[model samples]
Target chain A: MKARVTVTLKNGVLDPQGKAIEGSLGSLGFEGVEGIRQGKVFDLELADRSEAQAKADIEAMCEQLLANTVIENYSIELL
Target chain B: MKARVTVTLKNGVLDPQGKAIEGSLGSLGFEGVEGIRQGKVFDLELADRSEAQAKADIEAMCEQLLANTVIENYSIELL
Candidate 1:
């Protein structure tokens, strides 16, 4: 089985990296970009696990390590 | 208009950050996770631009700023 986890900064969190990228884009002549918020995606290969099991495992992973729950939100998709 | 950009490390690229997260997950008692590959997602709000124009602008952003073509791939979706 394959799983994808997307982790994103919560609203009101500052994204310095995204801001930097936006600035770089402006310098490169790309116009009309007002802002950028960057997040993370994790792709995983699982070994014969059921979708429910995988989702549970991934949720645990997110809470434990993949994301800082205080400042980030995560969602998992089984593929 | 709104746009989403997902950036991922190319296959065969080393991801130390992902490895670190996997390790942390294991220590936190999440089992059966073999590997984790991390990527980035960017959400942008555009100022009333056509989809084609936004896609073009985002492509330029990816090439010039959002992704390192040498080691990453990026896809843009207009929403």
Candidate 2:
């Protein structure tokens, strides 16, 4: 199975990297850009497993390593 | 309008960071993990525009600033 995980900063959390990207976009003349938030995407290939098992495993992976749960939120999708 | 852009490394490209993550997963006792690739996601808000215009503007942004076309591939999604 293939899985994708996206980790994003939680609401009320500050994102310095996103701010930097917004500033750069302004400098680059992308005038319409109002705000930008950045996040991470991880694509993982795993040994074949049932959909339910894959999802469970991926959730564990996020909780353990893929995300810092206190400040970030992570979503896992199985494909 | 809201837009989401994902930047991913092209296939066949080396990804040492991903390899490191995979090794760490094994250390974490997640033996099913076979391979992993890391990518980036950007969530942006823009001034109201027609969908066509928004799409065009985002395409330009990707080509000019969001992606390194030589080794990365980017996909833009309007929401």
Candidate 3:
């Protein structure tokens, strides 16, 4: 089974890296880009686990190490 | 308007960060994690552009700055 986890910054949290990217985009002539936020994606391959079990396991992984709950939110997708 | 870009490493490319992450998951007792690959996501808010134009512009951004075409693949999402 394959799964994907997307971890994104929570609303209102300051994202300097995102700001930097936004600035760079403007400088590179991609005009009218108002805001940019950066996040992390994890693509995982598991060994014959059921989709439900895989989702549960990856959720636990996100809670423990993959995401900082205070500043980020994570979503899991089974593929 | 909003758009998202996901950038992932191309196959056959060595991924030390992904390996480290996988190792960390195992150490933290999340077993059965066979393989892990890491990627990046960019969330953007645009300034009142049409969805079609937004997609085109972000595509350019991805090709020119957000993604390294040589060893990475990028996908754009319109939202």
TM-score of chain A considered alone, across all candidate predictions: 0.96, 0.95, 0.96
Candidate 1, pairs of clashing residues: none
For residues A31-79, write the lDDT of model 1, one tens digit per residue: 7778888899998876778888888888877787788999999988988
lDDT of 3 by residue, A1-79 (tens): 8889999999999999999999999889888888999999999998887778888889889999999999999999988
Separate DockQ for every predicted complex: 0.78, 0.91, 0.92
In model 2, state the lDDT of residue A66. Answer: 93
Clash pairs of candidate 2? none
Model 1: how far residue A39 lies from native, Å:
1.0
Candidate 2 residue lDDT tens string, B1-79: 8999999999999999999999999999997889999999999999999999999988988898889999999998988
Off by over 4 Å in 1: none
After aligning candidate 3 to the native by TM-score, how far in Å is the CA of A63 from where it should be?
0.8
Across all models, the iRMS values in order are 1.3, 0.7, 0.7
Each candidate structure's TM-score, on Cα atoms with residue i matched to residue i, is 0.92, 0.97, 0.96
Best by TM-score: 2
Candidate 1 lDDT, B1-79, residue by residue in tens: 7888989999999999988877887788777778888898998877787778778877877887778999999988888
Considering TM-score, where higher is better, how would the candidates rank from best to worst?
Answer: 2, 3, 1
- Give the docking tier of candidate 2: high
